[model samples]
Target: MTHRFVFPTLALALLLAGCTSLPAIDPAALPATPAAFKETDPRWTAIAPAEAQPRGEWWKAFADARLAELVERAGRDNASVQVAAARLAQARALLRDAQASQSPQIGLNAGALRQAEPGAGGRGATLVSAGAALSYEVDLFGRLSRASEAASLDARSREALLQSTRLLVQADVAQTYLALRAIDTERAIVGDTVEAYRNTLRLTERRVQAGDIAELDAARARSDLASTEAEAFALERQRAQLEHALAVLVGEPASGFSVAVAADTPPLPQVPAGVPSTVLARRPDVAAAMSQLQAARARVGVAQAAWFPNLSLTATGGVASPEVSDLFKWSARTWGIGALMSLPLLDGGRREAGVQSARADFDAALASYREQVLVAFKDVEDELAALRLLEDQSQAQARAVDSAARATALSASRYRNGLVSQLELLDAQRSELRNRRQAVQVKAAQQQATVGLIRALGGGWS
Candidate 1:
């Protein structure tokens, strides 16, 4: 308001900007990182260069066109993915709002007010004013700068979270579809066994009529056929439930969607497990956590900046006249310029509390980031172990299935030739069916684990 005060204000502003500073954020502040995974056995190796990005289409590795189509549809139509996308858009808007504070704000203003003159004979006069005003807050203490930085990092975190959500949805669809196919394979096996047992039962009845075998033998054959038929029906029910779940995942009504019964299990792809650090970095969840940590650190700087004085520069240029007709005349013009300095002399403990809260948030984000890193490595290792052991289990189950089939054939011949009892033949047949079903189940597990490994590695081999 006065020239005498202007020089002192300018000198004080220079001193505050020079003396005030916030703590810098360093990535090294985090806990120590692991160089490699704990279970990097000889069987597993680093991913290839081509696998690093790989277009992020891991489902294509199974070579299932239908699966690729379904995944693509889910990305486009799933409600959860859409919600995440909307959140990203909102974050971007908030970042823009924070950044806007750095720019000069210009606005138009117009108003009319009637006032009664005091100590007068109740006389009133109308005053009309109209103008454009400009204002800007000079970020001498870096408060606005830090706030903008925090908003920018928050938007990045939202983007990474969106990617994580999409990866989760895609993986879920693949595993559910694989499960449906596996049930189909088991159902086909049961269907064939039931038909074969029916033929055997008819032959047993003919032998009983000729007095070659007792009635008990015919009854045993009949019982085996009925049990196998019941299992096939159970498989059908399971398939219906899985199909319904799959439809919901794709954001479709269950009554309108169906997967045709497939007699073959889908192919299992070999997902590579890279070094632990590299794999963790590629994961979207880890990236999101790291971004949130950086955002928190920026907020801490913002809170510290709040303790320092704030400086702002403002300007106004407009017209003012009592009569509307003279509003635009040069004689009615008015303009002013100002510098405002705001300092919180005393506010109890609000500023200190804010600084502490910001620091606490930063610590929480840092912990979350470290936990995500640990979990990422664990997921990759778990899937790797499952795939390795399931491989061995599948091979052993295949051998059992083959042996069971051979035993059932020999026992059937022995019974027809009066060399073995009907009960022994039934035992061999049931054992063969059980072994076959177990083998199929093992293969299904291997397929599902393969998908899990791919997702853990962040979409592709790497």
Candidate 2:
């Protein structure tokens, strides 16, 4: 009767081991790419190559040595990039650990003890035993395989995320540098305007004393001078703030770092355009999201494998005797091997709940991946439209600045020759200032938009 029961139990274990269920998944079942790109302008319709560039040196296109150096430093020292890199290393270590589990684990056992008898004639003996034991779980249902797959995908995802963080840091440094340059330009303009206004105020006061102009003109000149001074103060404040921000972005104390402005404006780099669909593969975030989705899908397989039986084989061998010399004798040899199996006959629906939970997580991952793709497309389109409009506006602003300069020159000549009132000269002066300020603003906008385009294109970083 005992043999019959043993045979039935073995048969049940074998039957349960073959009961694993894995769902089928096809990569082709993923959603189609959305039609989000619009027709490009004829002048800007040419697409650039989408080949990856050297890692973390993408700012060389600007031809600014200082900017390049700053980017290099930030990439190496930035806290956020360091954190991402650490996470990537951790994920790789975890993958190694998971892969190691596929093989058998062996360990050594050794111990020695001494005890004295309770009688007056005390005696002690040293006990020394050494052996190696091994335990290995049979992955008959591919549970270990699926788990390793998930771990590898997670490692790849972390690597992609690190790349994404590096790109962001590089872009930020470049944008902040451009902003600092723009503020410096504005400061110069404001300084010259203030000087001109002060001269105008002094001349107006002289003309009033000479009875050539009314006191009202002097008051207006003073007001204009005051306004220009106020603008200069504001620009100074802005420059200081930008300086502080740039210092922090580069991982330095704000007070210890300062940026020197070049006399020439920084030229915008040429951005290569690509198809919207290509961005899905090039953007690090998008790639990371897809990897995460793959990992979650693999986890579904892992969860399903849990519903079947688990098989483990263990073996232990050692020599034991009351005397140390007798331990190696033939009579002291002892060894045993056994196979263990566990099947979930009834769990009050816990195994089913695990399957459902895994499915829900898989569904959420898919949704997140889709959303990332959509947002990536949207970002590219928005940058495209912005670049187009800003280019046109910049040209128009250049023409307006020219026209205002000519008008200012003519009005000043008329005032010197007594052909026009000082009020007319003042109006032209105000108009010229407004036009120049607007021109500076337009230039800044163009540079900023170009930077945005580079970022949207993943900034030539891989």
Candidate that scores best on lDDT: 1
- Residue runs of model 1 more than 4 Å from their true location after superposition: 1-32, 41-55, 117-122, 196-230, 272-280, 408-427
lDDT of 1 by residue, 343-441 (tens): 786999999999999999988888788788668768988987898899889889999999999999999899999999775786787679788989989
Candidate 2 global CA lDDT score: 0.77
lDDT of 2 at 179: 79
Instruction: For candidate 2, write residues 238-260 as lDDT tens digits.
Output: 87888888787778998898888
What TM-score, computed on C-alpha atoms, does each candidate reach?
A: 0.86, 0.86
Runs in model 2 deviating more than 4 A are 1-36, 39-56, 112-128, 211-214, 272-280, 412-418, 421-430
**Residue 179 lDDT (model 1):** 90
lDDT of 2 at 415: 90
Please provide the root mean square deviation of candidate 1 (C-alpha atoms, Å): 3.9
